[model samples]
Target chain A: MDLFISLFINGLATGMLIFLLAAGLTLIFGLMDVLNFAHGGLFVWGAYSGIFVYTWSGSFIVGILGAIVTGFVLGWITEKLIITPVYGNHVQQILITLGFMLVLSECIKVVFGPNSIPVDVPSYLAGSWEIGEVIVIKYRIFIIVIGLVIFGIFQYVLKKTKIGLIVRAGVMDKEMVQVLGINIKRVFLFVFMTGSAMAAFGGMLMAPYSGVIYAEMGMEYAILGFIVVVIGGMGSFSGSLMAAILVGLAGSFMAYYVPYLSLAVNMILMAIVLIFRPQGLFTNAKEG
Target chain B: MRHEKYFSLKNLTFLIIIIALIFFPYVADSRTLTILMTQIFIFSILAMSYDILLGYTGIVSFGHAMFFGIGAYTTAILLSTYNNTMMIFLISIIVGMIFAGIVSFLVGLLTLRLKSHFFAMLTLAISGLFLVVAEKWRTVTKGNDGFTFRAPDVFRDRVIFYFFVLVCLVVVFLVLRRFVNSPLGKVLIAVRENEQRTRSLGFRTLHYKVTASVVAGVVASLSGSLYAISLRFVNTSVMSMDITLDALLMTIIGGVGTLIGPIVGSLVIETAQHYLSGLANDYPIFERWIIFFGMLYILAVIFFPKGIVGTVYVKYLTWKSKKAKPQLPTQSVPLVKDKERFE
Candidate 1:
């Protein structure tokens, strides 16, 4: 029971991390139809930058803020420079973003060195609570809480705000939104920035959770993000969260039970999904 | 067809290149260059195979290295166990190709129906699974520290190996060219241009795609076999995403639909990589040369979206048309007459 709970929590935390990355990806992809392979680059940058600030300022919150800022700025620049040119061309987008991803990852290596940096949970969030036979790690709970809060906030903003309505409308039909006299380009830029910021925020959160941050982590997690996005519907937000949790739990359980097949389980899951529901588990019927 | 005879510029250039490649080993001063040329040949074959799917069929696969890796591992395992040189090498390549074809056929059946990005993503996932299997199946694969094998006596000679690989490259290129120019290839092109239209026209687009995949997989495995023979070693890097990306970059850089473009692409990229890494010691800036490589890739995509060969081909056609503009006056006069009569 204890093992199951811990594993469940572990899986949820990882899933939430992936959801953070996938949410931005799916949103950017959903609205803009841009496949930003450099999303992973934004992630690792956030991890490194957040960790740097955390060490410098001695506050995790400041680190998170710094990472978000970094992400927003980078995202804005990327949208303007890299992504704008290849709009509506999937192949070009994939190729250029992949190139940019390499640049981002290499730049990280150049700046921070190629070594993985170890991170620690904050002092307040370091210990675990023991309730009878169940020992609950504080950091995992913190991650879950943070993930839920962000999801709630994101959902609220998306549901209630004018920008949210425009984004949702844009996702449905850019032409329709443009016909309605909304600036779809501006919306695209805003959404791109927001999505990048979320990815960075996820990276920042992941640093201490994984206990190590590396340049290559972006690609690794980005694949997970892609998997989650695929498993969820391409642009469906709630689908990403659910699919991420499923992937996370599956990964965790498989790792413990069938260690050899652990790496392959998600892929097998993806393959099965592709065979049956190629559109994904929770895709909005009309979106595609 | 009459325009593409021995005197044509295209044929002449091809003949010249083939002749030069034939004589290269004999006249070359450095053994390193001969080895590099061999490497280029192997990669060119791999890139050409990739072009069949990406260029001809419009199927962007991310797991192409899986086929190449399969070829390498098959050869490696066979040679390691067996002392008979001819038997093992031939058997390994044949088995590798068969295995790759079978796997691709299965994979295509599952994945070819997906949207472009979904297909690419799924292939990546599938390839990642192959990587894991290769890394973990230590009993057969020797895991990360890949095993080495002895090649037949004929292949041990660098010049012999060079010519052998060159022949393979040229043969594969010709075969693929034939494949692409065939009536079926036209169907593949049609499918690439508009799958819905092709489907509506009563063509089984999926079968054509699967056939392309199998052909590509077989050719890629052949290259992989050559790659293992050239290195006398097998490792996971052969099947890594990097290899797939390298082939992709090569195909894009050269010219997608042009059969000869990938060869040129491989030559350019491989030579540049060799020289760039060599210069890293002299220049601190070159120490992180991958940044520059990435920058170049981005610039290439932006500036030469049609690729080098495709752009050149377009330019040649425009220039030729401009040169023939004097003849168009007669044609336009008739059109003018027709327009006046209609009025």
Candidate 2:
């Protein structure tokens, strides 16, 4: 029972982080119709920047803010320079963003050197809480809370506000939304920035969780993020969250039980979804 | 009526490329030749197979390496304990084709239903999942330690594995070339050009996509098998996203829709990467190779998006049109019509 609880918690935390990355990824894909492979690069940058600042300042909150700002700057530059030019061309966007992914990865090595950096949890979040022989890592709970909070904020924004309405409507019909008098370019920029920030935040949080940050971690987790997005639905935000949790739990449990199949489990899930629900779990987008 | 062939540019250029590739191992240092030629052949096959989906059928699969890896592993496992190189090769090809066809068919059913970009994203996710499986599923795959096998006799005699690859490539090129020009090939092209219209014509476009994808998968696996033969090695890296990117880059650089583009593109990129990395031992400038690759892709698309072969064909056609008799405008018919559509 304790083992199951630990795996469940661990999985939920990982899922929440993936949800954060996938949220940004799906938003960009839906809003601009641009497939951003560099989304992972942005997430990695967030992890590095947030952790760097956290270590320097010896403060966890400051690290989170730093990561967000780093994501914003990185995203803004990427949108203006790389994404804007290749807005309508899927091939161009993929190539350029993949290039950007490499460039970002290289840049990480340049900034922090080509080695892994050790990440530490805050003092208050380091210890485990034991209840009747069931021990739960405090930091895992903290990450889960952060993920849920972010989801709530985005959900509220998506459902209640004007920006949310534009985002939701834009995902439904980006071309029509453009014809309706809003500057879709601005929306693209906004989505790009938001997505990057969210990805970066995920990175920063994940850095401590993994306890070390490396350049390739972005690509690795980005893969996880992408899987979550696909499993959830491309343009569906809440779907990312739910799918992420499912994936997280599946991975956690699979790691313990059927160790060999754990790696393939996500793919098998994707294949099954592609077979049964290619539209994804929470997606309502029209099929092409 | 049979079109009169005064050596069409595609045929002529393809011949030139084939000849150059054939001479590669002979002229260059054995080590350099082996590495570059082998990489080129592997990617050439990869790019050609990719053309079926990306160029001919118009399904952008970001995770095509999954099939390539499947073939490599299949061949590796088959050949590891078995001695009949020919039988193993044949079995591996069938295994690769069947596996790719089945997986892609199932995946294509739903993801292919997605619009273009989303479809690509699904492939990426699915491939990523494959990587994790490859890395962690150590029992069957030996996990990160990977798997190794003795290099097969390769060509059985003096031809060497490189020449065998060359021969296989030539045969594949011929087969695919014929397929593209055939009725089925035309339908695949039609699907790429306008699926809805083809559907309106009562053709099942999805079936063609799956069929083309299966053939492409088989071809890609052939390359993977050849790669295993070449190196006498197999590892999880065969399924890595890096290989997928390399293949995509080659296909794009060679030209998206052109048949011969991938072959030419692979030769150019792999040779350059080889020389660039050979420059230093420490840095290998391999990272710089990535930089160049990244830069080359953007520059290639921005400046000559049609790819080297595509641009060459266009230029050749343009020059030929100018050289042709000013008296007959009919010679410029195809070129003029294509340009008109683009404009």
Q: Least accurate stretch of 10 residues (summed lDDT) in model 1 chain A? A: A84-93
Question: All predictions: root-mean-square deviation over Cα?
Answer: 5.1, 3.9
Question: Interface RMSD of every candidate?
Answer: 11.3, 5.7
Q: Write one digit per residue (lDDT tens) for candidate 1, span A232-284.
A: 98888888899999999999998999999988988888888877887789876
DockQ of structure 1: 0.47
Which portions of model 2 miss their true places by more than 4 Å? A173-180, A283-288, B1-26, B84-111, B129-140, B154-159, B282-286, B322-343
In CAPRI terms, model 2 is classed as acceptable
What is the TM-score of each predicted model, taking all chains together? Answer: 0.95, 0.89
The regions of model 1 sitting more than 4 angstroms off are A284-288, B1-3, B326-343
Q: On residues B215-259, what C-alpha lDDT tens digit does candidate 2 reach at each position?
A: 887788788777766666777888988888888889878887776
Using lDDT as the measure, the top candidate is: 1
Residue A31 deviation, candidate 1, in Å? 1.4
Candidates, DockQ: 0.47, 0.35
How far residue B29's Cα lies from its native spot in candidate 1, in Å, is 2.2
Each model's chain A TM-score: 0.98, 0.97
Query: Fnat per model, in the order given?
Result: 0.57, 0.36
